[model samples]
Target chain A: MSTPYVRRFDSFDRVLHGFLMLSFLGLAATGLPLIFSDQPWARRMTGILGSFEVAGWLHRVCATMLITVFAVHLSRLGRRLIFQRDFGLLWGPRSMVPQPRDLTDAVGHVKWFLGLGARPRFDRYTYWEKFDYWAVFWGMGIIGASGLLLWFPVFFANVVPGWFFNIALLVHGEEALLAVGFIFTMHFFNGHLRPEKFPMDRVIFTGRVSLEELEEERPSEYARLKASGGLAALQVPPPERWLVRLGTVIGTTAVSIGLLLVGFILYAVLT
Target chain B: MRIKHWLAFFSVLFVATLTFVAAKGPTNIPMKAPPAPSRPAVVKAPPEPANDDCLACHGDPDAKSDTGRRIGVDPAKFTESVHGALDLKCVDCHADLKKTTDFPHPSKLAKVNCAGCHQEKVAEYDRSIHAAARRQSAGSVAATCVDCHGTHDIRQKTDPKSLTYPLNLPATCGRCHGDPDVIKQGHIQIGNVSDLYKDSIHGKAVSKSGLMVAANCTSCHGSHDIRKKSDPDSRVFRRNIPNVCGSCHEGIKAQYDNGVHGIANGRGNDKAPVCADCHTAHQIQRADVASWRLDTIRECGTCHADKITTYRDTFHGQVTSLGFVRVAACSDCHGAHDIHGKADPRSTVAPGNIVSTCRKCHPTAGENFAKYDPHADKHDKARNPVLFYAAGFMKWLLLGVFGVFGLHAVLWLPRGFRERRGQAKHS
Candidate 1:
């Protein structure tokens, strides 16, 4: 038996998420040309970007959108924590601590991979996922704060020593290198490289889960929902099941087409 | 029926509210006109008094100064002055009329700046190092015109009493410039040039003990047209140094350019010596027996110490210090302005041409002596390869030995907390 999978994100949250993703991607695309300016490819990239002034305006607009989305997300989180009484999910005392058993499990997993032991039991969220999420949060905070400092440099010039600007430049560049490296190497490997999840992960969009998936992947959360008397909602009636299935098919098809269009446009422009 | 009635009534109310809001929006209020400014009132005042009566007493020719010097009011001579030429009255320069009891005397006066009149001469003077110091020490009794020329009876060279007259120039100019007390007080560094020039090769050819016809104050400073060295139009500019000196030392300048020192200076090397550095201005003498017995290299070595030390360490200096006439001082390999570097295609000491520049004196000179940089000291091992090899090898061997020892420290040193944690668990 599985627990009911409530829609996790509101409409506002989904819209904000989309805006953030678009702007972040736009900034990265526009900024890379300026970074590798000495290369011949940079010239071609700049040309495709249509004049630096227009590109600059587009980048700033995107940045503003990203910041607005971040503010909205923060407000939602604040409301959830204060008014909605959902602080238990976040700011709850964490139990995902490094323990003797966790160490043993980690060692066993490594051993299993080496053909020296059986695979260890795992829980709902892996240590690596927690690390990646926290890293992104820290990266966003640092990059955002440094960017604000750089944006209004004259305000700080009177209070801060000149050397701080040099330090800010160094930190901005190195932090960017770390973020890009992690995104391409570790995040891509973890998020998109698994065989079953290989071409896509649709759960973020649908905000749903199957009984078998809940049992296999999130047994602890499933058990909690069952204890909380939410399991009845998990069993969909025959008529509602068809409706949900139809919704999923249309939604997935629309999303897939949109993603392909974006990819094709990008390919045409970049080349 | 009630729902339909309420919806129709509310729709009519909404339309009425929308119409009201539209009526209140965007009225183009006319701009208010700005107030006109009032004109300023003019204030009238009294007229200036006349000074025609004052000129009566000042126009007298028999008037004498309190110190008994004749204060002859020479209108003609005064008119020739720049202030007079500019139509400036004597009263413009003088003030303090209340205390005066004399006629043809300045009622009051301020010290005159001749520069206010003679602007071009002042500009030329200002750019020279002498005028550069004037701002700092303006009140110092330094080289003013009256110090060389008499104040009341100043004249051109044609006048017998004129300080610039050919026979009298050196003695007249030297009187203040050569006085040990005056020179010391003024901190003038061109040491006793008036005395020394009186005895130079050119000096001996002239008639008097203290005067030279070929060279005098005006010979270098120019009669009345003396210009500053900073001006490119001036004869004494650095770029024109070789040619200026060559006017008298033609044979020497030709030979000197082939020498290394002249070659460097011609290429704009500030470290290279100018003609004045060794022989010196004001104290110049012939490089004959009286001076040759003394080490010429010692004089040149004041600035070229490393070269001096390097040359001393060589066989050339060993013979030269002992008074060998053929030994080099600085007039070897680097000709004057005609000099080009070894890198230049036309260079006399270029690898292809070095044999010839050396062959002028050393017919059998090998390439070894020609390749050596004469300015370099033997102890400067970085430039001297044999010493560099010996020192560098020993230093690096020691560093390599120490580096091997340091690796032991690095490899086992905690190896960061992550590796330490793993190691502890394994143990």
Candidate 2:
């Protein structure tokens, strides 16, 4: 029998994630060549994109999309807190926010990886997942702010000192490199390339997880939901085969592009 | 006494003979003298050969000299010539054959003297290097009048068929200048300048594009009195190059004259750059080309070594170094012809004007944005301490993150493999 599914993310969240994935990949693909413009591959890539000017336009368009996704995601959270009065999102087992339990889980998880202790039972969001969430927040502030300064340097010159441009240039490039490196390698590994999820984890795309997967991955949350009889409310019919296939295609394409971009970055940095 | 008496008588006879000859004039004097005594004696003038008389034998298609050299001149081409159109007689230049009554004259004749008619031009050529070389060497084949202008078929310089015409002048000069054998024989120091000019912007304009105003060999180097480049009066001489080029590029010359380099050059600073120093002489290319623009950075660096070194550290310099021209280059900020000291009010990079200069690329650039030092050197702590420390911090931060995370990812590979193996075993 097909295992029953549980809705982990709403459709809105899934669509926002899709936009985030696409825009981030677009930004990295276009921006990396500018940073490493001296490389032959950078020239070739820019040529493929028509010209450096086109690459620049593509980068700014992608940046706008990313900014839109960030704004929309924030507004949704704000609506939940203000209108729906859902304060549980701010602090709880299901919260994206870091709690004291995340510290214990991190230490325990590392210990388990080292074979010195049993694996930690993650409730809903693991420490790494929380880290990824907050990293985006930090990335948005630093990279986004600096990028705006560079994009509109003349306008910003009135407000800031001239030396600020040099500093902004340095900060924008370095922080972007850090963000791209983190997302492509660390985030990819944690989200999909781990032993259990060696190929991919499509729950983000399909917006649902099988009951067996939820039980195995987050046993504590599963147990809590069952005891409170909240599991019935979250339960759903199995995701359609077509939906799963669509998610797989999208998920695989994004992963492949991300990995390919990472390969280009490595080639540029190494040579 | 007898010898002395005879000597005196002979001297008196010689005087008498001289007096008689002076009074009688020549034996060929015309008997029909002027009726008035005030009119001078009219002596019979020598018979001259007409153009047709010379052309009778010389115009034959197979006419040859005693030594079997072709001595023929085509009548059709001669009729169209400047001298022929003027109806000049053959004896006008061949003055030695003027009085000759013989049907066939000597095979060898006196060389035609072009200076007889073109005295001023010949005087100028006399002072030229070619004339000097001819005077120094016995058998020197240095260019002469007939070498450039055709002997019988000479045409006006304005005519397109003229050798000295603007369009054909390069090839006329290139006959010797471009010939490897001639260059070797003449010990020419500057190699194949003709070939170099053929590929240059001016040469292509004149030859390929057929631009009448484009400079040729005779434009920079004067036609009649072309001198050695070392001669201060030579148009191509170092100090005179600006004026020579300025004759064509009036506006750029005006701007350059007001700039620092021009000012220095005017002050007799030989080291100060002139037009040829940067753009070169014969191999000059259009400055708008990407390769030329990139190359001009190094050309400028030839003088401003420190400035170029610092410029190379900037984002603009780095991008340009990679062969991209989207960013600003040295001349983009400094101004190509009107470059000045930063303190100068007219300078593009001056304190008051820098903001507007930055606005050329960044339309909304304010004073604060203009403060960005494009030539800031991170290694110089005293001058750029902020940049120095910031560059240092970023360097370590990148290395630290990559080092630690790289190590973590490396260690995780083994663990990941073992976990996967265990899962496979279970399955």
Candidate 3:
């Protein structure tokens, strides 16, 4: 029997995710040592990066890539909205926005988790996915802004108070930590680490989900596609096993690095 | 089969060795015992003079000279001197008198050479700058043995009556150094170094505190072989400063030997400072004192112009400039003696160790806080654009994040509670 699959994301989204992962990892790897420069391990890590000067260079390069990738993503979203006139992509169940149904789905899921009601059947997007998506806009804006301020303090200082520099340092470091912590803990678990998805769900990387996975995770979306006669048009050959394996390696490495960083950060915060 | 046989043989050998080792060890080794003292003591009188008849006329109380100067001598005072104690006669020093048979000498006597008896001291004096200056200028500005120690009344330095004793050294050296005629003639600024020494920390200790081990003139400069600092052989030479000071300041010298400046000096860099450069030869003060520690900043600033300027703009620099003594200075981070480059792991200012160094002033400072460079200038974007942008980004981010997140939290908390209540009703 021919295994069925559906395209969940296009190549552009996968490339964006790749860029983000690489840049985020680059930034964290080169940046944390600077934040905790007095650590012996931090010193060794900086030595590997070729001194604080080299680390600074790596950090600036990664920061530029991160900023560019985020800008490209927003521009793509704009182009979709303005040129493509995909008004539906911005709202409702198909959109990355919260809706009336999403609230019910959230309340229903809570009841299920609490054992008071049945689990809500998610469509194209769940309330958690919406939260995750919306959080990026806020986090990226905050982290990016603070990063810019730190990168051009003298110019900003001429226009603003000196205390702003101190504030920038605090926010940039704290927000970066928050982002790393969340992506490592909440996002990893919800999207990849949970038992149902353990080891991973490779749709984000391969841009395709197995039919069985689609049916199990988003039965409502499957039923809606069937009802609208779009299911047949979306169906394609299942992703190659090697592609899935490649994603496993990428996902596992990314998550492991995240876990390591989170563990160190927790130690710093608690201690 | 051969390996097994060898192992068995080795085991037997090891067992035999263990048995021998367990036996009691011998305590004694063949060594000769030292012999006891055998010399006998005997009562003896002072050596008899070669010519007691010379002292009879010369040591008289009413003796007169051709220049009308009294030549009176005190018998007891003479007996107490080093020469008198040795029972030397006047003719021994004045050898020309032995040639004279008449009461009045036929011709004048040649100048007596102290080297006739004090050969080592005379040799040392010959190598001295004073001796060189005397030969160059052909003048009496050079100090001979009689200049520091009187010819007829010379005493051992151990004696409290000696002019060379620690307590009397300042006065002895200052005699010629304080004289305006000697200063003008020799073209030397003598009073500044020796005369002012009497009012310094060492002088005060020697004069008032009765500190027996206090440094004196001869402590830094050799008495017999005193030379200008420009001479490498001089005790006060710049290259020999650490050793000269180290004789007394052993601990500071040990610290300096491991320091960057000391390491540089060891590599033959003449630019590096030695003891006398920072702390003057004569007027050194207690380094621990607040006023004196403040002076060290200016001294360090002399060589590190750019660093001092940046440091002055820092919080520590501002506080120090305002006369606050407790603030951290260059020596506080880069240690006073054990200073090294930031790349050196042992360096106090190295990235890995900077936190502890900072904690000296900021007790609770963490690695994060230490990341804030005290000498960094936010006004120079060309050097540090990241810090500049970070500051601006944080300012606007704080305002936007607070405005948005603050509103979100304010609305969400009450909404969350309402949603829970609604869920309860539905359930």
Candidate 3 Cα deviation (angstroms), residue B135: 1.0
lDDT of 3 by residue, A239-265 (tens): 888988888899889989988877776
Locate the minimum summed-lDDT window of 10 residues in model 1 chain A: A90-99
Rate residue B62 of model 3 by lDDT: 72
TM-scores, in order shown?
0.34, 0.75, 0.49
Which candidate, 2 or 3, has the higher DockQ?
A: 2
Candidate 1 structure quality by residue, lDDT tens digits, A98-203 = 3465556556645654557654555445544555555556666766666665554445554554334433443443454445444443444444333334444444
Best by lDDT: 2
lDDT (Cα atoms) of all candidates against the true structure: 0.52, 0.81, 0.72
Number of clashing residue pairs, candidate 3: 18
Q: What is the CA-based DockQ of model 2? A: 0.39
Q: Candidate 1 residues B1-427, lDDT tens each?
A: 5575455345434544544565567533221110100000111222111123244543466766677766555555555543333334343333243234554445336655545445566566665544545556867655665555554344556555567676677778678677888788667776676788676655555534433346555665554444456666556666556666777678878866765667787797867766766565555666655354244567667776777766654434533443344545544664433556668767776778876676566565445435445443434666665533433453454355335423422332333233336545876
Highest TM-score model number: 2
Q: Which ranges in model 1 have alpha carbons more than 4 Å from their true place?
A: A1-13, A91-112, A115-124, A232-271, B1-427
Best-first order by DockQ:
2, 3, 1
The DockQ values of the predictions, listed in order, are 0.00, 0.39, 0.02
Q: Please give the range of 10 consecutive residues that has the lowest summed lDDT in model 2 chain B.
A: B32-41
Q: After superposition, how far is residue B248 of candidate 1 from its true place, in Å?
A: 34
State the weakest 10-residue window (summed lDDT) of model 3 chain B.
B32-41
